[model samples]
Target: MKAARGSVVSKKGVPWGTIISVVAVVALAAVVVTYYLVQSAPKRALASWAPTADNPDPSLNIPGIVTGQYQASVHILPTERVAYDHSPPYGGPHDGYWAACNGVVYPVAVRTENMVHSLEHGAVWIAYNPDQVSGDALNTLKSKVEGKPYTMMSPYPGLDSAVSLQSWGHQLKVGSATDERIDQFITALRTNQNTYPEVGASCDALGAGAFDPDNPPPFDPTPPGPDAKPMDYQGSAGTQQDTGMPSSAPTS
Candidate 1:
């Protein structure tokens, strides 16, 4: 059989077929060579002077900006990941916001505004904020709605059983940030929350013993307005996120 013009030889005298086989072999060789080149290429390393475990931020670089709407560059995921997805805390990852605030490292949760910054370097955790019923107990409520009708998806339009709690925590809280800002340019994203035993929201003791000692609770931490850019800090992993307590109310 006459092979195509590019073919110079044939396997068992099958000329055109030999041309196809030769092309296939060449393609495979190219792929192998490309793979090796990629594997052998010099890696791009961070600056030699870059921070290390011993001195994390030598020049004081701000790291891990998670909650301003951009997805976390780093995240706290379940230790054991499944086949294709992360096994996040709570019934699902979304629950952490309404109920998952506890999963957030206390320092991160308190940052409330600069969430991503915390997720970047600090330890991540999960815990649920148990809802309390105050004011009135109405009867006509069939199943009693059982605890705040709590679902991760509440307070948002997009999610189904999947909701972004960390998103809500930032969005709903006073002086919170808008989701679009962080999310706009992000390429990858995930939200995380864990649970912890219930802690008292308020205390009666005054002075150093009070543990906040305010009513309806000074428990909520609202971030400074989006425009209130965060300042840099030089401290331990935990202190990096410290905006301190949100002033019970920011002074005008």
Candidate 2:
């Protein structure tokens, strides 16, 4: 039988099979393109929020620009444990283990000490108070964090603010998820080799016991005792100058 003119049938006269295969191939390509766009949308949105000023190399000198937006740098002994002054510690002596920062968003609160170790590896920690942030705000924060390499987010049960962003020695807190600084902090610091103590370290393959997302380490939400080490310690116990601590708040 002669095939109709302008029909989809091949010269071999196979009609349905060839057409189906071509449609399937096109559909697969479309799926791939859609996935790429979806994955890249957050990054593209964040790029527009980056600072216009030349950002100093964080790996070179770890500049301490504490004038208005910046915070003071702090380094301390690599202690097995510490009572950090900050709820979600910015930087200080920390446990050897580091929470997995390869884009993991831990549902439960993570240990402050171990997360500090993640900061040392150039991971930005996004912490939020579960009681304060929920609904659309929480989802918005997750979109910015989930699947983003070298970043981690979890609840800080008694967080000083509704949301907090922390790098090696930098921190910024915002009252809401919509705050513009959320994107700016992530853009400025993720894998920023200069600001952290041990840059280029693997955020992955940290100790297996370090962080099991199914069962993350509980945060010590209680206020530090009078003897809790000050966060501004400069690489020595003696140099840890006393500083005011955040008042403890009820956990969500």
Candidate 3:
């Protein structure tokens, strides 16, 4: 309507600023939701692959998996060593004390005897050849082991493969760190009640001397001497009683 001269006019228009802010918030929310779903997808898939009576060891389904039938409760003195059948033994007679496998990543290659003990406790030992794996490849493997219970990783000085995963009697070697089978092996075996011997066994380090994760016994690269114990050798006397207990000396 016609109004008096110099009168102001009131206008109603779209709130562009408010509309832009709202759109931005919605877009951000969508991105966050997508990221969450993507990150969780692998874990969700792995959950379905848990060990079942009908399918006891799901890892057997994975290609290239090697299974063994090693006797349990066989222990060795800290001073002794095993002439393991495999380069990185999956299972066999081992030291009385166990390596700290509660998501530990040993900076140096740990003593084989102690690490095998961890496998008896359902820990998945991820061994990688330091010469073959490094940079992003090594980091990828670390992501899977770090902060995950019943899991550990170390540098295998003379490993034949880029990566080798060991869990009790199971072993899988892969040419790369990003192999899908790595995760599959871990999900199927680590702490799997149907597979490992010492169910509910602790992965924590026994203590300072027996098996210290911080200053663990170094890996012995030399060939197991003529005196090295055989795979079938029965444990030393009283060694079985020392399982899970700390010793006065560091395990080597």
Candidate 4:
């Protein structure tokens, strides 16, 4: 009888070991799944922040939304040069040529007029003050701009704010690179047809020669003409200055 009892006890031990092994495998899988979800939390949050059809206009009465008497007309100049009212121009007359908006990260400042052209093509331009942004903050902004079609970023030497985000007819200034509104602006305006002045304009169709991210046109800090018009498209062009626009438009 003792021998029979021993056999039954040994059989019970084998089953218990198998059950433990199964539980261990399941627990490992659950941990891996949890880790991936945690890693993707921020991206998921950004995706969820996107504007829907009913709420397409996120700029309306949105605090920090740039509202002013800026121009909203389109003028194509023979040159890629423009005299803009805003330092990081919202929109107005732009160079006939547009910067390549194919997810380019311009290390140096790009011409404001070329950038405005990109915005007209449904691109979102992000500008930051070099003196104010660096290290992780700068990298975070770069990641947002890099390899994402219809997006471009460049440093503005004399930006009135630490960072400014511009889309056609829209602008937002923020004090930090990690500001929640940064993502909000990108989500609300990036490729939003309702906000575009030229819908279906090809952002990538612009020839590569117009802009080279690695060797972009250096930012010219030359001040705009004394006759520089306010940010109005309907407003007539200011007398062409021999030099580029101002170092930065005075922020209201």
TM-score, one value per model: 0.20, 0.62, 0.83, 0.77
lDDT of 2 by residue, 46-161 (tens): 66544344655332222322211212323333332466655667776664456788888888887687788778788988899999999999999998888888898998887778
Off by over 4 Å in 1: 1-15, 25-121, 124-252
Residues 1-252, model 3: lDDT tens digits: 366332443343567899999999999999999999999999988886689989998998889999999988788888888999998999999988889999998889999999999999999999999999999999999999999999999999999999999999999999999888888898899899999998988899777868888889889999999999888887765563345454444322
Task: For each candidate in the order shown, give its overall lDDT on alpha carbons.
Answer: 0.24, 0.67, 0.89, 0.73
lDDT of 4 at 191: 89
Q: Model 2, 249: alpha-carbon shift in Å?
A: 38
The digit string of per-residue lDDT tens for model 1 on 1-252 reads 355643644433657778999999999999999998787652212233233466432222213222322222111111111110111111111101122222212211221222222232221222122132112311211111223112111122212222123321122111112222222111111221211111221111222321211221122223234433222211112121122232232221
CA lDDT for candidate 2: 0.67
Worst 10 residues of 4 by lDDT: 239-248
lDDT of 4 by residue, 1-252 (tens): 999999989877657778999999999999999999999887887675566787776665456887443333344443435567566887776655567787888888877877887887779999999999999999999988888888989999989999999988789999999998888788878888878766766666344454555565567788866554344433224322112232132212
Best by lDDT, which number? 3
Order the candidate numbers by lDDT, best to worst: 3, 4, 2, 1
- Candidate 3 off by > 4 Å: 1-37, 240-252
